[model samples]
Target: MLIVSGWIAVDPEAREGYLAGCRRVVEEARATPGCLDFVLSADPLEADRITVYERWASDAELAGFRGSGPEPEQTAEIRDAQVHKYRISAIEPP
Candidate 1:
């Protein structure tokens, strides 16, 4: 399993608009094969932040769905981000 988690910074005023624009991508990701879950949400404490999380069944699946990443126009709006991919070796009751 794999998990991608992080947060992104954007203009406070443009934050809602940015998240709105991501609706389609988020929808598509949730529909894709091997995608366990995908989410992009506005942070409660940070007006300019968006929290991101995604889960995939395997590396191949994640790579296939990540084709080309976010659009350039969308990427341009991100002022800063800290995202990371984690490879999970096992899972147990949490």
Candidate 2:
């Protein structure tokens, strides 16, 4: 499994539009095959900072979705963004 987490720093004035685009992208992403999870969240202390989290069944699945590129509206409003990926070796459910 693969995990992806990131934060996007958007223009303070453009935060709402960016979040709307993020929601649209997340909805589409969650419908794709092999998409385990996809979500976006706001940072409580930072009005312009948003956090993203994603889980995929495999690298191939992730690449397939990511190949489409970033959402235009979201990208336009973003001042900076960083995404980190991880490969899961094991999972334990409580």
Candidate 3:
């Protein structure tokens, strides 16, 4: 499985707009093949901070959905972001 996690700092004035866009993005991504999950949340400590977490069955599916660029609105509203991808080697349920 492939996992993706990230945090984005959005323009304070554009926070609501960015969150609206996030809803569309998450819905679309969740409908795509091999998408396990796509979640977006606002940070409690920072009003303009957004958190992202996603899971996919394979790299190909993730690439197909993400493409090579960020959405236009994303680039416009996001001031900064940090994203990381990882391959899950194991899972344990408590």
Candidate 4:
């Protein structure tokens, strides 16, 4: 499985809009073929911080979703928002 985590810092004034856009993206991504799980969370102590947790079947599938499709625009909007740190890793369950 492919797991990705990202930390996002949003503009204080644009938080609401950013979150609304993120919600739409998450919903659409969750419906995609290779998406096993998708989640967005806010940091309790940080008003402008947001985190994304995602699981996909493979890197190719995730790349395909990133390129073209109905959710691309919304995803791009979220990406264009603010600076973020992200990581992707392979996981094995015991």
Maximum-lDDT candidate: 1
Could you give candidate 3's per-residue lDDT for residues 1-94 as a string of tens digits?
9999999898766787778877878899999999999998888889888888999999999999998667785787778899899999888997
TM-score of 3: 0.90
RMSD (CA, Å), each prediction: 0.7, 1.5, 1.3, 4.4
Q: Name the best candidate (by TM-score).
A: 1
TM, every model: 0.96, 0.88, 0.90, 0.68
Off by over 4 Å in 3: none
| Deviation from native of the Cα of residue 47 in model 1, angstroms | 0.6
Return the lDDT, model 1, position 10.
98
Clashing pairs in 1: none
Worst 10 residues of 2 by lDDT: 68-77
Pull out the clashing pairs in model 2: none
| CA lDDT of each prediction against the hidden true structure | 0.96, 0.86, 0.88, 0.67
Q: Model 1, range 1-94, lDDT digits (tens) per residue? A: 9999999999999999999999999999999999999999999999999999999999999989899999998999999999999988998999
Worst 10 residues of 4 by lDDT: 77-86
Give candidate 3's error at residue 94 in angstroms: 3.6
Candidate 3 has an lDDT of: 0.88
Candidate 2 on 1-94: residue-level lDDT in tens?
A: 9999999898777777777767778888999999999988888889888888999999898999998688575567778889899999999997
Query: After TM-score superposition, what is the CA distance of residue 43 in candidate 1 from its true location, in Å?
Result: 0.2
What lDDT, from 0 to 1, does candidate 1 have?
Answer: 0.96
